[model samples]
Target: MNRIALAVCALALIVAACAGSREEVVEEFLPSLESTTTTAANGDLPSTTTTRPAEDQQIDELIAGLADQVREIRGLPLALPPLEFVPGDQLEERYQALNGLKSIGSTRINEAYLQALGVLPEGDSAADLVSFCSLPGFFDPESATLVLREGLADLTPYGRRLLFDELAGAATNEAHDWWGTMASLERSGNTEAAVGLWALVQGDAAFHAEQYVAESLDSTDQFAIRLEEIACQQESTSPP
Candidate 1:
C-alpha cells in the first residue's frame, strides 16, 4: 500500500483511546488537550490557573472547540501532500496552519476541512484525532504514540526523542515501551512500523533483550542483502 494508506491504518488503530465509548476513556484522553506550562529554566511560556495569560486561555478555548468536533468522527482517512514535498519539509508551514486553525476553534471548519482532506472517514474519527491534537498531549509518549502512529510530522527530532525517552523511562509499565507496543502491532502485523521499531531497538540498549537485539541484527543483515539486490536490478534496468 502507499504511505497514505499506511498512515490511515496507523491512525485508526492508535487513536482508539481518543475514540473509545466510555466516559472514562474521554476523561483519560482529555488531559492530552490541556495547555502546557514550563518554568523559566526551560524557556517556555508561564501558566497559572487563575492568572493565566490571554493567549494561553485563547489557545485552550480553541483546543476545546476542536476536540468537540473531532469526537464526532469515528474514522478519519489519510491524505498526503504532493510527493515532491520531502519529509521534514514544510514543517513550519504546516505548524502555522494547524496552529491557526486550532486557534479559530470553529467546529464546522474543522469538520469540513478535515473531512475534505480525507483525514476523517467518518465524523467520529475526525473528532478523535482533533481531540488527540487539541489536548496538546503530543509531548507525552503515550499521547505521542497516537500521533506518531497517525503519521503526524509535528515534533522535531529532539522533541520526539524526549517523548520516547520518557516512555523508555517507564519501562516498568507494560502499557508503555517498544516491546509492549510491538506486541500490540504484531497482532496487526504492521511491518514497516515493526521494522522501524526494531531499528530503534538495535540502537538502544535499554529497549530490547539480547535475543531480540540479535534477531534484529540478523534481520538488518538480511535487509541490506535485499536492498543490494533491488539496487542491482534497478541498475540493470537503466541504459548502459
Candidate 2:
C-alpha cells in the first residue's frame, strides 16, 4: 500500500481501539462535567445556574489567536468563518446534518468494502467510528462555520491542539476549497482518489496543528500532549 493507504489503515485500527476507551481518555484530559454555582449579578440572591466556567469563556479569544497562528504557520491568508459551540448532546445531530449533503449510500458501501478488507472492524460503520473518534470540533466547509463542543474554555492541552487542527482545516478550506474538490472527485466516480485526497487533507491539517503546538505552547503542555498521543498509539498496538 502507498503511504496514504498505510496511514488510513493505521488510523482505522487506532480508532477501533480507541472506541473502547474513549471515556477514560476524555476523563484523563478533560475536566469533570459538574455544574458550577454562581451568584446573581444583583448580589442579593444566589441562583444555581449551570454556567460555563470562567476559564472556558475565553474560547473565542483563544480561537482568534489560533486562527492567526494557523495563518502564520500555513503562510496563507485565511478568512475565518463564524464560530459556533454546540453542546455535547448535539454533536451527532450537527454531524449528521452536515453529512446529509453527501452520499450516505456511498459511505455505507465504502464501509462494507473496508470491513471486507479487514481495514475496519465488522459491525462498525465508518460514519459511527469517525463521529466517535473525531476531535471535539470541526470546520463545516459547506456552511463556512467552525463548530466546537461547548466547555472547551478550560484550554487543556488536548483542547488547544484541537483548536489548532480545526483552524488549520479552515485555512486549508479557504485556500483550496476542500469540499468542492472532494465533491468533484466523488462526482467523477473516483472513490479511491477521493479517499486518498481526504486523508491527505486531514494529514496536512494535523501536521500544521502539531507545528502550532510546538511553536506556541509551553514545554509542559507540549510534553503532556505528546504523552497523550503516545499513549493512544500504544493502546492501538496492544493485543486485544
Candidate 3:
C-alpha cells in the first residue's frame, strides 16, 4: 500500500510541476504577446523618428563637417557620409545631417524616391534624402538649368531660357548628361543609348507630372505635353 501511495505522490508532483511551468511561461510572455498595431502616415508603413537634444545636434554637425573633409581628401564627391556612419536614433536628425552636407535638393528627394516608390509622393524632400544607394533611387539627368525650363510656373523666364541654351549645347558634353546626350545621340542615330535615357526620363516625368496634376487644381497641361513629346520622340526613334 505504501509503495502504491508513493507512486501516486510522484505523479501528483509531476502534474504540479507542469502546472507551475505553464504558469511561469504565461507570466513571462503574456505581456509581450499582446497584439500591437502601427499607425501609418498616409499609405506608408510606420516610420520611426529620432529626436535630438540641442547639444547632440551640434555634435552631429561637427562630425558631418569632419566626414566631408575625409571624403574630399579621398577625391570622393562632396556628400554626406552614409546613414550607417551617422550617430543617431532619429531618422530625421540623420537625414538633416546628410542634407546639410550634400545639398542634393528637395526635388531629388520628393519626386525621386518617395513618389517613385509610390509610398508618399507628397513626401518632403528635405525629410527623406539619402546618400548613395545600393539601389539608386532616381537620377535627375537634367541640370539645374533644364529643370528651370518648360514654363512649369515654378521657374523664372530667365532660368528657362538659360536651360534652353544648355539643352542646345548638351550635345557637346553628351558624355556627362543623359537626357541631353540621349537626344543628341538620337539625332546622330545612336538609338540604343537614347532609348535607355528616354526610358529613365519618361518614367520619372510620368510619375511627377501625374503627381503635379493630382495635387494642384491648375489645368495647365504644359508638363503633360512635354512628357508626351518626349515619349513620342522615344517611340519614333527607338529601333524596335
The C-alpha TM-scores of every prediction are 0.20, 0.64, 0.19
lDDT of 2 by residue, 181-219 (tens): 666656877554444445455666777777887788899
Clashes per prediction?
17, 1, 1
lDDT score, candidate 3, position 165: 23
lDDT of each: 0.30, 0.55, 0.29
Q: Pick out the ten consecutive residues of candidate 1 with the lowest summed lDDT.
A: 74-83
Model number with the top lDDT: 2
Model 2 clash pairs? 56-153
Would you list the rank order by TM-score, best first?
A: 2, 1, 3
- Over the stretch 1-240, how does candidate 3's per-residue lDDT look in tens digits? 011222232233223323333334323322322221221121111111233333434323433333333222222222231212222233234323322322432211213322333433354552332221111011123422111111122322222222222222221123234445545655775443333333333332233323333443144454644444455445444675
TM-score of 2: 0.64
Off by over 4 Å in 2: 1-57, 96-109, 127-134, 227-240
Residue 21 lDDT, candidate 3, scale 0-100: 38
Looking at model 2, residue 152 earns an lDDT score of 50
Error of 2 at 156 (Å): 1.2
